[model samples]
Target chain A: MSPVSQTRSPLDWVKTAISRYWGVVGVLIAWQAWVTITGVNSIVIPHPINVVGDLVFNPGVYLANAGQTLFLAAAGLILGMALGTMVAIVAWSSRILSGILVPLGLIFSSVPVVALIPVLARLLGYDVKTVLGIVIIISFFPAFVFTAAGLKSLPPGSSDLFKVFGASRWTRFVHLVLPSAVPNWMIALRLSAPPAVLSAMLAEFLMGKSGLGFLFRQSATEFATERAFGTSVIATVISVLCFTSAVAAEKFINEKWK
Target chain B: MNAPLSSAPATAPEAWAINVDHVGKTFTLDGGKELKAIDDVDIKIGQGEFVALLGPSGCGKSTILRLVAALEDVSTGRVTVEGSNPTALSRAHRLGVAFQDHALLPWLTIRDNIALPYKVAGRPVDDKRIAELLALVGLSGFEKARPRQLSGGMRQRVSIARALVLKPDVLLLDEPFGALDAVTRRHMNVELQRIWSEQRITTLLVTHSVEEALFLADRVIVMSGRPGRIIKEIQVPFARPRSPDVQRTMEFHHLADELTLALEPEGHH
Candidate 1:
């Protein structure tokens, strides 16, 4: 892929980008055309230009709420992943613990995390902490499931090698098992990141006083369609950023590991 | 430490480095069926002896190696290494092993992979020892290379370096070259012969190749498959520091033929 790309000129990069993102460009063009053709009221469905205009003109408002949402998402993601990995290690250390925790994990994963947000908000008093809790719960399932599976995926004959080397449980876990799980852990990260952003926004929309979700809700309630659409655009960009960064991180780690 | 099974009086206690006393292993399959992997296998190695257990695939040769490596338990008998249980030898960090898969950690450089045993045993890393081993395995200047960057043969060399890094009392190899191409395998055997001569650790190599067994072992114990049992034991006559040229000799061919014939199916034999 690199060799072929190197042979091509700068124009090819433009061509590749167009090929990759044509669908998005086409959708934007179609949305603009529909709004212009239907002559819809700007209050009902603002033009894309109006949405972009609101984003550019109201940078401070969007930035503040985006900052809050980003903080909640990033913090919840890290804490949830850390908690899940710790639980996975504990389960791996004992068969009885694994037998109990794995089924409970499956059950928890099966239920929709969004449904728990309202109940949790009621219990935790409809605050930022509840929003954070919702994000953490949303992100925890993949981390736990993927990490549990990853801990068991030892490289071929590595278990035998460790046993033959007289490695204690701690030694094996640190040197062998933990490193083996990294690739799978990265997968969990990539899977959970986008949802983490979305869940944080959802939680904020339901009951928070700030964040992209609350910003969207407040804008829509006030009939500020352009600001609401701008909020959505910002949320989408953040989600995409999270996904691409996770993918980049996964690629870098996989290259170094394998 | 003396072995717990001291009642076996046929041999003196300390002379044997590894003693597999009538060891048998039966694995219970799913649905309550029993599969006997090995049956009443008895073998003993003197200090510094290079013994080979040669058999076909699924002949339980690897099972015997596993028993000695303390990776598997013997059902009916005991396997003692260095006058104690195999586990004792391993726990003391006195056993080294290499397998067909070349089980070097992909994440580590060659140098770190070779240095792993020291880390596992809670010893400080010995840079000089690791360098010496890298040089000995003909892998000098390749220290920073990971296993993936190396060829199949080079990866095997790294695994061998890791096994020998601690100067272990016993080196157990189960088909260490079984996955290599024939030419590379032969070359590795030559390199291994040189390596083994330098250390002279009590070694037990398990292989299915007749030539490999004849070329490497001081004594080759051949086993039959399906409830594996020893079929023959032949003492190799080639002197130590044996060159690869000895493989072309008339006596070597005769021995190779004999072992090959023994390894055939029962009717053919």
Candidate 2:
């Protein structure tokens, strides 16, 4: 074998890594070039380097706010998914209930869900609980709709087989319906994860004592332009991480379920 | 090998394993109109007997099978098994059924699919029985494979093994090999015959193939389409352990021709 084929060099490894992350590298290069060329006032749009400097110098501020936001988002997501799944199971138990709730769920899901945040803040009072509630409401509809669809979409002829096998209603639900619904449920999870985080931050921005959203507002008002931009960077990182993890979880479940 | 057959006693009031007593079915369409699918159809299957309901497409032969399997209720009459309602048999987990779709759970391994009836009945999973069925179906080495990974014929074999896992008192097969090619279907028929001979469970098979019905059934009942009713019944004269050679016999050909003629369109007659 040729030496090049037998042993890969350090330069070859670097070349592969660059090719894989070229898009991200290109975006960073373009942002730096645009800032340098325009020389826009730092107050309007901080330099990328200034934002990085803010993040590095003041880690405690970012860390505390990010921790709070992540906690609220994760907790609210769990609560909303549980509530949605319970309601779906209740609807599945009765034709009359399903008929009543399915259309209502569709209506609620189609409505501008984020638009309700202000109204919810007014009604529930501008507290951390309201922020949590907003995230819950944002995530609930997809879980309900996707799970309802999954419960009904059984393998062809398997329902008849279940009936003929003398399966009880509970047995059928446990073995057939629940397992079948898992992949769709994972789809709902992946679709809702990033939005869950975004909505939590938005709620915090509207009326919260502390969070990344509050930090952004505080920094901007005080003319700490670099700190505000740093908050945005952290928020973006968090959302991407949440979305990537959700996608990975969905792939894992789909492989097992299908 | 002579399997022990569970034939009913001669003095028993219900000697029949399955009785479709003047059963009729009517289905409602999208509109308020009613379409009669079966009309005054009657069938009696003896214990340990293999009977085939043979009819062309659109005939209610499958409807009759569905009635006996308790998948559908008769609109005008009753279907009974062992002197009780068909639903009783199903509820007791003594009825086995295989449909044309195979109906194997795609997510489950072949062994788990066979063991599903046990789980449904709230009985412990019998690993030995599942292994035995896997061997019987000629799928011993494929126990860990999923249904989608197998060929169509192999999937149907897994379906059949699942049906027999509980050693159900009655077996209902609705064109289990209907999705296969001609050669594969014929091969399935031979395998099914050997399997049925060994089990000797009371079986009702629904199919449109004249040769399949004759080759596998102890008796063949032909039905007419559009408000399905029995047109004719023929007792298969072939002995047990019937090999593929029986299909080449003159008697088999004559019976096949008769059944084919029965299935022809009314205009042709």
Candidate 3:
């Protein structure tokens, strides 16, 4: 059955929208109510309305920082996935290589990736490249692990069929092994993509001159609470967008592939 | 109907398209214990002959087919096709095969799935041959349909079409309809018989169904489980271009019952 069913009526669309987004809506309403009840000083914690005003009024500032962060995250995610897939294929091909690399990959994945950012910044220099590296490192493990598993889980008896047909190594990889890994690769993407955005922002926050992370830091230091709150709101939106888009892509591919 | 296992002639090697020369296969278990899957099995399929290996589950009839398909190495003796090693036939892209799972690539359309042999063989896709096969399998209009869109029987048909597209010297079918319902399986046997009559390619089918074996094969070799060995061999007396009504005949039932009795456990009444 198709997961992307069409809505039959306007009422159906509204019901679906509420079911999907009620949690986020509820959180927003609670935050607004708390701000109104407290009557807190604006400099300490600005009203939700004030944060929205800053976002609406100063689109140019937010746009430039957001664009930078988006580019870094997207670029890092693609490179990481590509590298992971290549390594996985190499591991699949050579027993010795997999024996050495798979365990190492596991170890790297187990360590807190966020903790590595400051150390990486010191070694790689405090720049955009480090932020990109952080994002890449964060995204790599899931892709590598999932792709390796997928490569092994071919359709039942397909490996035997290919052997009987006398498929060349490269031909088998292209026609059988690579395509087999697609669904699992989509899974890696869904798991890694949202984290890619978060890692990029965190790297920017630690040691960077631009991006939403730096904007947030600058606003907080200067007592511009509304701007800081606006950056957080934008960051949350971007992260959620990444997650949803990855999920959508996965569903679309699985419909055709599975 | 049961004949001595070794009575098969050891004459001209060229006449035999697939020759399993006293083959045996053993597997090393995870615990390092040896498990004998097949032992001292011999089968010689003549050129354009249809032979079916019928046995119960775990009887290693499939292992025999796998040996001839060059998918597994025989622990003892050898398997040859057309006077050369079985692997050689595979390397030449002259071996066709279908299994219980169908094994069609789900992402591809029916036409492309059938054309996969050509792609694997590094030959240009033959559109005419693919069309011919699609029609041969009675799936001509389903060229654009992916494997997921088709029924199980339809998918198996596509796998069969793909196997035959290359016009291989030998066809190996390992329970190609084993997963289908009774009605569909019977229908498929009729379809396969019709298809085989046109091509007349030498085929070796592994199955558990006595009726199916009797219906589709010129000869049936039944095996006993546990270090599998051929226990009974029967030359089917049914004429070519056999109709489904042949199954209702007394002679067919007589053969089926005999084979079924042979398949039963020794102590079972």
Candidate 4:
């Protein structure tokens, strides 16, 4: 193996990282600059400084809300991933189960969860649970689709290798299936993470007494546009965090493995 | 179809590494059309003989390897490894296979890929044996290199080393060196011959190149395509411990020419 050391210093690496991702950094800077230069009412597009300041000053409020959303989303992510994987394996291994699930999963995936939100709110109540349920439904398809595709996507030669090597069912899953599914799992994770937060917000938007969504609606009604804009800005940051984490994971995998 | 040939006397009279007898196969695809891939093909490989199946593509050469490896079943007849049904053998450590594509696990380093047979079989592999294989394949320094970082030649070497790590009774290679450039292919041939002789394991190579068949094999088995059957078997009486110099010998050329004539269609022959 080659040495791990890179030519650049840590600070230099950070600079390089920012430079390499200039498109994203450029957008952020342009957005902040435009708001600062316009001198418009904070309601339209509050300056990034003010929005960030609001986050810092109201740390307890924002962090707690962010934490709540993350917890529920994480729960949904785990639940959906597990169920989807088992269902996918069953579908791939058995013709009868595959026939049953193939169309059923598609039909379940087709019906919009957003449309079901109202019914969910009535049944599960307009609370964190409803939002979590929404995330599960919305994220389920990617897990199911990717796992099934990943299982089937093993090259034609792979099955032959399996037979020659006498790979047990468990070994096949661990050695072949798991690594093959990593890329697809990442894809599903990326697609699902944002929906977790979005569904939480949607739930809050429909029914809430607290959280960023609640704050936005409260400010909107009171017409304190700056705070409403500030809350929205914070939500965008949460999204950036999700997107960046996925990107980082992808970079790590490509470098370390393939 | 010809009767199954017994193992040659040169290696051993009683012990056989591969015993494939009257093996036949037919595949019925999704459209319900029938495809006969092999037709009562029979070949016996002695304990240490290096046999090559030489013919044009689609001659069921690969199918034979797969059946012996127990990757696919012979719809009729039998393939046994040391008289045991290849599939029934609890551990596949008895056989190693390398196909056209070097199916080295992309996630593992070269060292790890070579060690996978032992890893998956849950047995402690002798590090010394692995090092010897790496040295034989000329891959000692690149153990930590991943498959993607390697050139095609290097990857194939890693695949071979991985196959040999288990020290199986038989080694099956299906067009293993076909994808390499001419220079690399020739180099690999010499390397493979040296390694096989040193290990003394029975080796079966399936290829379309008559020169490759002549160069690497002690005996060449040629097949006819379209309901694939063994058409001819030619023995190379060339001396053991073949090197690069052997490729230019009259014996090598003469054997290659005859096999070429046998492989060609009516007009070309």
Candidate 5:
């Protein structure tokens, strides 16, 4: 029916696919070339093939570690986002509370959060709970800031309309403020997803009994380069998955809420 | 159209639908100096009357409407609605208002936007009433469309529908068609007249357009610039169910010219 439908060809399909995935193809080509030309020690940097082989042969180990890391990240992300949103609601209710906490949130967000991982591990005793806590603290700031902004950024005159309608404070918050804040909340989710995974891995790498970060550490210590590379690959895959899902979620909400 | 309430009862003491008794509004500037926006402005609207406050920009016409809508407190004097404070009327969900911006909620459909006042009043959503309002505003088929999907005039109609969904005792319109183009504005004015004729609610409209004031209102009050005060008042002679042809009459043109002259800067006329 359309010109594009009529002119479409297999070559066009190949061109579209290459345009979409050029970065991945380029990276793989570069990796293989480097491995072939350098003739470097496999112990330091294993071939991509060897890493793939390790992933295929040790699926159980990768799966278990990935599951732990994902669970920790997802659980921590949910807890952190919930706490942040609750605090944002509280801030919205009281100008004095917003004044007190908004500056504190800004300061904490500006600080290097990862630098506090070791201190937190030492203080909280280097357990899985501490790892979860680390991820939560890292993810909390964006949620707070974005949700706070969204709560205040109402449609012009709609606030006055609400007031003139004699809306109770609770009704205004529920019907107007909460819906207004959803798009910004989704933005916070998308921005925080990768950090959630990264922070979970960092926390585990610092000190944890199990997870991908712990697996990488154990493999590196044992001089199993292929297994270490496999863990890195799996972490990359999980982070990408989390980020993409969050982006998709944000898109869905923006369509409905905007 | 329903007949306006008889003048006999309206002539009784303290029987006005809205009473702005010597109201004055002063705003404090950033450096602590005060700017008076309106000075000793007095206005009263009878039950079922449509009164338009015609003024130049920054003349505080909107401030008058806002006071009656309970969106702002009167800086001086008293504003009463039906023998009580404006706040009480609003609290009872008997006040409706539409602003120039047509402030429909972007997240809501036209139906949901019109139904918002019910939800705000903590009442059950009346789908039939919402449907009726949609039909009244000529938006029956657009109930499921969001505000942004509609044109400017359509959005204003949706806003007007939202304002009237509760069948409020008093309606305040602050240049509700101010953002529309000239042709669309005239068309909307006709639509609004049709709609208002159906409801016959007591209304106060703030606008600067002489033709609009002449066409849509039963009484037009002309206001002067800064420190806004009512300069002149004229009872429109045209009958109800007025057609656009009335706007072309010699009487309408003469009144429009007189009002336009009154709106000019003080030394110009």
Candidate 6:
């Protein structure tokens, strides 16, 4: 509110950077230690070294597949988050809407969507549209539920404050309800991201070319367990990266709006 | 007699700022039960009058204030502000409110918090008005300070300044000083009186403390429970520019005790 300096001090920068990477550093060191001590078969858990070599040198044979998977997941996640927030606004605005959306969303979520892959293939034709649709369906409901509940959960006094001010519907969405609901949205996104990634993978496995899932299916056919294992690790790292970035973005928004 | 508020405010009383007539509210519990929060509330508050809706907890004192502020609707009657229906008063700058909690946005600094209504309505922040508000609330030096950086009393002061920045026709304060320590609350009471007198703004405060209600209000309306309704109205014959010393006078206690007795349990009566 005040005219304060925009830049962080050097000490503040160091603190922020360390906090962000602390888990990553711990994971690397622990992973190296585990490889040295376990002496397990390389097929089950390739040394982090071999995984990194494949990640860098093979430079995305599977990574390219991973890139495609990431694209689908990212697109699906964004569509889901945006549309989910809008659904929440609708649900919150009218009791009738909540009633309608509740049963619709529940039924949508029930009946394992993975089972409908062939239906989707029949409709959208075995392609990325089909894969992203899977991600959208898997990712959207939780976001919608949380966003709706979060908006509705604003403290009595807060809503009253907005009401007294005669705030526009959109204004309340952008200001009062949105800022207060950041924590809930973050929790939903964390819950939804892994499934969204998995959904994309499943769709890719079922559908076609270019994705870590395709690599996974191909490697399984060849019985190259190490490559499959490596691909799995790479997939995991991608998920973590995606989830972490989403979480960090949420945290930054929370802090800025706090 | 529940009715929508009218948008017409083409003409209004030169004397009174708020008018209520048998306005009431009741909430239906989850199982289709009803809880009466307020009932048959009627009051004609003059322009620039400092009044308190005082009663014990659950007496619906706060509910009355919220109704006038247009935060909630009346169940069976009507309420108006500046001779206009509050519910239909669609402008954001018309009423300034401060509640028990400061409710200052933690993200914004003291100045921005004060300047928020303007900025939120797409009007640019008026720096001069912001500075004047900060100076008035004794937050002049901390304009850039975030709500979290300030102490409790300091935060409440910022809240007050924020409410005042818009120069609202009425100021609705719901136990604004209740959360502060003894000393800070007393100091704020004095500061509030000064601001009220200087601005000549109509104020409606809801409070449980008899002395606090007595010290601040020009007239205090006491209410009774369950189906909450006004039980008595007592006038504070005290002089203007209220200071802490005015609290020690016999007249203050006389009114305080009268309001307190009105709020006591009905069995004893």
Best-performing candidate as measured by TM-score: 1
Q: Considering summed lDDT, which 10 consecutive residues are worst modelled in model 1 chain A?
A: A1-10
The 10-residue segment of model 1 chain B with minimum total lDDT is B1-10
Q: DockQ of all candidates, in order?
A: 0.75, 0.75, 0.81, 0.47, 0.82, 0.28
**Model 6 stretches with alpha carbons more than 4 Å out:** A1-57, B1-14, B22-42, B72-78, B88-92, B105-110, B119-124, B141-151, B225-232, B250-269
What's the lDDT for residue B126 in model 5? 95
The deviation in Å at residue B60 for candidate 5 is 0.8
Query: Model 2, which residues run further than 4 Å from truth?
Result: A1-23, A103-115, A122-125, B1-13, B265-269
lDDT of 4: 0.79
* Tens-place lDDT digits, model 6, residues A1-258: 346489879998788779889998788779778977988776566677766676667764875788889899989988988888888888888999899998898888896876878898889888889988888888888898888777766644666666666677787777777766667888788888877888898888887666888888887778666577678887888888878877887787666655
**Global lDDT scores for all candidate models:** 0.91, 0.89, 0.92, 0.79, 0.89, 0.79
Predicted structure 3, TM vs. truth: 0.94
RMSD of each: 3.1, 3.9, 2.7, 4.7, 2.7, 7.0
A139-192: candidate 5 lDDT, tens digit per residue: 898899899889998988989999999999998998898999999999999999
Assess candidate 1 and give its lDDT: 0.91
Residue pairs with colliding backbones in model 6 are: A1-B109, A2-B144, A258-B107
Q: State the interface C-alpha RMSD of candidate 4.
A: 2.2
lDDT of 3 by residue, A166-235 (tens): 9999999999999999999999999999999998998898788999999999999999999999999999
lDDT of 3 at B15: 59
Q: Which lDDT value does model 2 have at B57?
A: 83
Q: Write the per-residue lDDT of candidate 2 for residues B1-269, one digit (tens) a residue.
A: 22112232343427678878788999999988999999999787878889899998888988898999888888997888988988998899999999999988877888888989999999999999999888988999998888878999999999999999999999999999999999999999999999999999999999999999999998888999889988888888899899999999999999999999888866876
Please say which candidate is ahead in DockQ: 3 or 4: 3
Tens-digit lDDT string for candidate 6 (B229-264): 888887777778777888888877777677777888
- B1-269 in candidate 4: lDDT tens per residue? 12124533443323567878798999998999989999998788876788999878888888888887887888999888887888865365577888888887777888888888887787896788888888989888887888889999998998888888887878889999999998999888888888876786788899998878887887899999778888889877777687778889887788788888888868753
Show what share of the native A-B interface contacts model 1 retains: 0.71
Provide backbone clash counts, one per model: 0, 0, 0, 0, 0, 3
